[model samples]
Target: MPAVSIDINMFWQIINFFILVFIFNKYFKAPLMKLMDTRKEKIAAEFSEAQKNNEDAALKNKEAQKILKDAKDEATKIVQLAEKKADERKEIIISEATVQRDKMLKSAELEIQKMKHAAKKELEVEMNQLAVTLAEKIIKENLNSDLEAALADKFIDEVGGVK
Candidate 1:
């Protein structure tokens, strides 16, 4: 053949292009897609785990705050109760002291009254005895006169009226 015909113009070039595309899909494209899917799944699993950990930490913080509030409330109640008890004890002590003081004052007053009465009785008895002795001395010294008889009667009446 001195010169070829042009009926198969560009046919060999198109066939070579299709074979290259098929070989690249079978050997490189499929494996690349599988690797990309696996990496995406791993990243998604890590993100989910991080989210769960954050939720757990938030719940723990809330519980800790609640416990702290409860402890503070209990402490306040204990302090108030102690103050009330102290007030009650103080009142009881004051009342008991007042009662004891009153009792002691009454006892002292009664004792003083008894002492005063006994002193008055002793003074009256001594005065009467001295008056009788003086009268006897006067009578013995002046027995021979009428004036002496009248004096003796007056002395006896004075001595008898003392008590």
Candidate 2:
């Protein structure tokens, strides 16, 4: 059987390896891991903030579009209202003009009727005078006032009565 040999150098090497692992864990490995974790958290926070900003921008754009559409609708309504008012005004003016024209026509007709009545009265007076003269000429004598009036009445009765 071969003899197994244990060396003191192997024990020292094991102790040295444990000391190196401890130093690395305390000084370099723990700080490096902590720095990596901080960097990851910062990157995550930045991404979240960017996403929130994007959502807010989208909301603002939608609100702006809605406001523009409402303005256009309001403008259309205003134009329609103005046009309706204009049409109403036009109709009112036309109706007023028609009323004025009708009043003028009525006034002219009344004036014409008054003139016709006055001319008829004048004609009647002339006819009565002519009848009195004709009666005097037929009798070959000047008539008194009472006789002239009677002759005039008789002449009027022989013709149709005045209107």
Candidate 3:
């Protein structure tokens, strides 16, 4: 009797375990599998978005590099143009300055020549006046020794005044 009861108890435990397994399969398996599938799809979509973002980043980097190079090249061209213009302007300024200097020098030389000619003319006029005065004295006075000495002194004084 005891052995039969033990065998029956073992049989009941086995049947109970099978019933629990069936309940779990009927109630939980499909929902669990659906949740796992949803999670797996979400993960795959995120991975795909990450790969797309990475590709976009690479393309943007290349575009940025190209833009930077173009900017540098444009800056170089601008600097070169500015330098060329500056050099041309410098040459123009120097040329104008040189012309101005030459004109001033020529004007100075002409002024000096005018001054020298005026001085020479003044000296000639003074000499002519001295000659006229001496001739008049000779004609008015007698040819005595005292008169001659006085005339000579007057001529010397007039000539010194001319100098």
Candidate 4:
């Protein structure tokens, strides 16, 4: 090497710079780096917790969807069962109504037959009584004006006073 020129002021500045760096490192660097590491750990913990909560929310949503689908299917089944019961009830009611209508018709026919039989019996009794009375009167009366008058009066009475 050639002759080295040493500057005394530059050498003193370099020494001062090293001392300042050593003081800064001893006093401030460790706590600052420790604070930065603590902050990083806190951020990571929060992010992981948030991701866990998001997964839980997704699971709950899927469960809720399954519950809703089950409810809808149960409602459909209940409606179908109700319709079946109603149809059966309707058939039962119709059958009962038909039976009641047939009974009423049969009762009305029996009543009509009884009424006709009663009317025929009353007419037969009246005819027999009138014939017996006529024979007795013809035997008791003279075949003259009294008989003719009696016959005419009976005829007028039987005809409801219209002669």
Best by lDDT: 3
Give per-residue CA lDDT, model 1, range 1-163, as digits (tens).
Answer: 5385545656777777888899889898988899999999999999999999999989999999999999999999999999999999999999999999999999999999999999989987887778777877778577877787777778677766756
Lowest lDDT sum, 10 consecutive residues, model 1, at: 1-10
The lDDT, on a scale of 0 to 1, for candidate 3 is: 0.88
User: What residue pairs are clashing in model 4?
Assistant: none
1 or 4, which is superior by TM-score?
4
Cα lDDT tens digits, model 4, 1-163, are 5487658987999899999999989998999999999999999999999999999999999999999999999999999999999999999999999999999999999999999999888887777667656854664464457777677557646753332
- Per-prediction TM-score, please? 0.61, 0.55, 0.72, 0.66
Error of 4 at 60 (Å): 0.7
> TM-score winner among the candidates?
3
lDDT of 2 by residue, 89-136 (tens): 999999999999999999999999999999999998788767756754
Clash pairs (backbone) in predicted model 3: none
Candidate 3 lDDT by residue in tens digits, 31-73: 9999999999999999999999999999999999999999999
Give the root-mean-square deviation of each candidate in angstroms.
Answer: 7.4, 8.6, 6.2, 7.2
Worst 10 residues of 3 by lDDT: 135-144
Higher TM-score: candidate 2 or 4? Answer: 4
The residue pairs that clash in candidate 1, if any, are none
- TM-score-best of 1 and 2: 1
lDDT of each: 0.86, 0.84, 0.88, 0.84
